[model samples]
Target: MARPFLYRCPITGNNVQGLTSDDAAAEGEKSRLEMVQCLACGGFHLVDPAKGPLPPVDDK
Candidate 1:
């Protein structure tokens, strides 16, 4: 199976996977900023590959 594309939630620093390039492209085209709600932190954040992979932050 193909590995899923992953990104980090800028707000909570949680790892978010299962997002495909097509998904990002569609979102990017729709808005100036592609924001996604973090399932871990429940906060909205931007996904940018340029930021690199970020380690998950502890909420506590």
Candidate 2:
């Protein structure tokens, strides 16, 4: 099973939520898989790209 991870907003330092593999692939103009804007600062980040590649799994 994958583990849960946490990230902080670059602009506000607020706790950001983690992303799942599905979330990464579904990212579009309005959606993203990385550090989303924090309600406090509205800053965004790319989260952990170097963590490693995602495992193979069927789309939900």
Candidate 3:
């Protein structure tokens, strides 16, 4: 089993459990397990461990 990821919501400070790579891809056509929504403040964020923060992505 893969390790669990940890994420805290900036808006509400509530921690959210992250999804694994396999589980994330199993969400169907609209796979959206990358970032989870904050239960308290309704915010969304990523939980990447390698870079500490979400990596920079460019859409060009």
Candidate 4:
């Protein structure tokens, strides 16, 4: 089952949410690389799930 992951876009600096593989979800606490497609920049980046998925931004 896929799980949610989060990362910051290097190009856009947007806190984006993404899904991870079943294996990755099982090891979410571990340091592993997850490639996230940035919603703000439309670029691909590799980020560690351990470091982020920062708290929900207050857009208001």
Candidate 5:
């Protein structure tokens, strides 16, 4: 089985799962700054993988 693409909701700080790669791809197709409605926060946020799973922590 393939791992689902997970994204972090910056508003809620929750992990949201994309059931399939196609879903993630569709989001990316829109644009890098495409906004996705967060199921957790119920608000729109950018679908940014850079801020997704295992993102680096800013010590500052």
Candidate 6:
């Protein structure tokens, strides 16, 4: 089942909701980066699930 997660957008600096797939949900809380669509910036941002609700992505 797909689940919702909160992540921070580096571009917009806003908290956004991200939907996870079955594969991701299976991995739950693992230290990995996942690309999430940012509604505020309308772009993609890398989010780490283990980093809590506010995931930070490197701008570099």
Candidates ranked by lDDT: 6, 4, 5, 1, 3, 2
Superposition TM-score, candidate 6 onto the true structure: 0.65
Q: lDDT tens string, model 1, 1-60?
A: 333446776655557763324433454454323466567777766765434456666579
Candidate 2 or 5, higher TM-score?
A: 5
Error of 2 at 59 (Å): 42
Q: For residues 20-60, what per-residue lDDT tens digits would candidate 5 score against the true structure?
A: 33334555464444456677878876665434553544558
The per-model lDDT (C-alpha) reads 0.56, 0.50, 0.51, 0.71, 0.58, 0.73
- Over 1-60, each residue of candidate 6 has an lDDT whose tens digit, in order, gives 876888777777778888776564454554677887788899988887556576465668
Q: Where does candidate 1 have its weakest 10-residue lDDT segment? A: 18-27
- Stronger candidate by TM-score (3 vs 5): 5
Of 2 and 3, which scores higher on TM-score?
A: 3
Model 4, span 1-60: residue lDDT tens: 877777766666577887777663454456778777777798888877667755555568
What's the ranking of the predictions by TM-score, best on top? 6, 4, 5, 1, 3, 2
Model 2 lDDT on a 0 to 1 scale: 0.50
Candidate 3 lDDT over residue span 1-60, tens digit each: 655565665655555555445443443454244565555577666545333334334446
Q: Which model scores highest in TM-score?
A: 6
lDDT of 2 by residue, 1-60 (tens): 434556655555456555445343434444345544445566555766335333444447
Candidate with the larger TM-score of 4 and 6:
6
Model 2 vs truth, CA RMSD: 12.5
Candidate number of the best lDDT = 6
The RMSD (Cα, Å) of candidate 3 is 7.7
Model 1, which residues run further than 4 Å from truth? 1-4, 18-33, 49-52, 55-60
Clashes of each: 0, 0, 0, 0, 0, 0
Q: Candidate 5: list runs displaced more than 4 Å.
A: 1-4, 18-31, 49-60
